[model samples]
Target: MQYSQLGRTGATVSRLVLGTMNFGPHTAEDDAFAIMDRALEQGVTFFDTANVYGGKEHRGWTEEIVGRWLARSGRREEIVLATKVFGEMGPGRNDRGLSALNIRRAVDASLRRLQTDHIDLYQMHHVDRSAPWDEIWQAMEVLVAQGKISYVGSSNFAGWHIAQASEAARARHGLGLVSEQSLYNLLSRHVELEVLPAAEHYGLGVIPWSPLAGGKLGGRSEKGVRRQNANTRFDSEGLNDQLGKWEEFCSERDLTPGQAALAWLLHRPGVLGPIIGPRTMEQLDSAIDAVDISLSDEDLAALDEIFPGPGGPAPEAYAW
Candidate 1:
């Protein structure tokens, strides 16, 4: 597996993040453990999960599954474990958001479920509009002081939100957001419009979720078509034509659609890695193999022609 520093930090991580979102709800614990085992053995040391994973009825179930895996394997020191906050774990108003109260409660709860003493990366699952930056930072400072969380991260944040959060942390002489997780892939280039640029400016690594565009880029045309139509992106005749071209291009390069898609992200700016949530072992292997499939200039140019970005970054992408 390829390795790079996490953003501007000195800590290094794999280019492929092993996302555990499907652990409890979709994958049995045994299968999840096997996947995590293989990921670590393969040198993919970054694992990302969330507090609200495992669906609504069994919140935190995913983390519990991971906790068991970590205990069984005794490999906590080998992986960079990441989990999120800001999702409602219960009905109480204090159960959600990034307020100082929830942040304090959530980290402790997550630590217990994770069966770990410290979280390598504690991410805010979303931008909680109700929580002021001062309050959030104060809580994070306490966690850092207490050694409960080594670093802080953010997910699903707008470019402006990263700016606001980072600036707030800077004023306090904090490390700020070491990473940002966003939906980014060959078919999803929205983050390139601003978020990627902002992350680069702030030295936050870009961890892309849904890196395969939910399997549309996985070479399974039948399944891809089925999912795309539901999402309204490939329902139109013109889009179907583009997807057909996409498959044809992958075939010509002797690459699986998934490998090509991941390779593209590996080449994108500010991207530390793409989070690959594999339900099966084969899928995990496919993503790991993608790290070595270098894309030439011509190959990238063709991909750009197939799945164009937002013209570049704004305001140059828009005003200029």
Candidate 2:
């Protein structure tokens, strides 16, 4: 796998990050281990998880599984582990958010679950509007001093949120956010409006989640299969036409829809890599193959014609 620097940091990470969100819920422990083993063998050194990824019934279950794998495989040092905070982990009022109290408690809890002393990259799952930047940076500073977390990151944050947080870190002389995780797929390019540019300006790597657009770009869902599914935006005729065109384009180049979609993101600027949350070994294998699928200028132009982004970022996308 190709490697890239993690933001402006000296550390380098694999271009493909393995996401373990489905470890306990959708995939069994054995399969999860196998998938991780495959990932490491394929040189996918980055693994992303969260404190609240295992679903409502068994929160933190995914981390527990990862902890077990780490204990058995002894590959903890080989992976760049990332996990998130800000999800409700319990019934208590202090169980979530980016507050100093919660961050301290949550980091300890996550360490216990992951069987690791320090998180390589500790990410805030979402921006806490009520939490002040001073409070947030102070908490992060504490973690860095304690060696509990090496780097900080944010997920699902807007463009302005990134700017605000980075400026706060600079004020404190702390290493600002090293990455921003957002939902950026061929079908969903909303981050191009501002988030991508902000990350570029602040030297934050853009790690895109759901790069397959919930299996839509992967050609897994049949046409009209989810017409009644309220969660999907594919209920419209326009979206169906777009998907049809995308599928045909992928087929023409002898690529699976998933590979084509991933290849498209891999070539985009400011993108460190796209997170691939595979439930099975086959899926992991398929995702890794995308690293070798080269896209020509004409191929990229064709993709843009099919799934256009927000014209190029900020006012340029809207005004003069």
Candidate 3:
């Protein structure tokens, strides 16, 4: 697998991060273990999970599954495990958010559920506007000092949120956020407007979730169409047109749609890796093979023509 620095940090991580959102929910424990085994065999060491995953009935079920896998496989030392906070873990008012009290309780709960002593990367799942940066940074400081988490990160944050958080951490002489996970794909490139630029500016690695646009680019057009419910992006006619062109382009190059889509993300600037969440072993194998598929300048140009991004970041993309 290809490797990249985790933002400006000295740590090197696999270019493909295995995400466990489906664990204990769509995928049974046996299937989840098999997928993770295959991923590790293929040299994927980064694993991403969230405290809020594993369906509504079982809030931290995914982490529990992962913890079991880690204990059984004894692969904890080999993996750079990541999990997120700021999601409701209980019905209590303080069950969510980045408040100092919640963070303190949440981290301990996550650690217990994960069955690990420390989390490699602890990410804020979303921006908590009500929580001041100073409070957030102070809470993070406690985690860092206690060796509960190695690095901090953000997800689904606005560009200004990154800047503000980074500045706050710097003021406290902290490491700040080393990475930003955002929803970025060939079909969904809104992050190009500001988030990507902000991450680049702050020297934060960009780990893109939904890199395939929710399986639309996963090489199964019929399946994608069938799964297009009200909340899915595949319901739009314009997206269908783009998908047609995308499929045609991939077919011409003798590549699977998923492979081409992942290749495009692997080449994007400021991207450390794309988080691939597979529900089955076959899907995980297919995603791992994408690391070998490289896109040339002409191929990239063709992809741009099919699914154009924000024309190239911020004011230049609109005004100047």
lDDT by residue for model 2 over 11-98, one digit each (tens)? 8999999999999999999999999998999999999999999999999999999999999999999999999999999999989899
Candidate 1: minimum summed lDDT over ten consecutive residues — where? 226-235
Total backbone collisions, model 3:
0
What are the RMSDs of all candidates, in order? Answer: 1.6, 1.6, 1.4
List per-prediction Cα lDDT, in the order shown.
Answer: 0.90, 0.93, 0.91
Q: What is the lDDT of residue 247 in candidate 3?
A: 82
Error of 3 at 176 (Å): 0.4
Stretches off by above 4 angstroms in model 1 are 221-237
Worst lDDT run of 10 residues, candidate 2, spans: 226-235
Per-residue error for 295 in candidate 1, Å, reads: 0.8
- Tens digit of per-residue lDDT, candidate 1, span 244-304: 7888998998998888888889998899999999999998998899998988999888888
Q: How much does candidate 2 score in TM-score?
A: 0.97
**Candidate 2 residue pairs in backbone clash:** none
- Compose the digit string of candidate 3's lDDT tens values, residues 1-320: 99998999998899999999999989999999999999998999999999999888999999999999998999899989999999999999999999999999999999999999999999999999999999999999999999999999999999999999999999999899999999999888999999999999999999999988777786654545523433476456787677778888999999988888888999999999999999888889889999999899999999889887789989899987
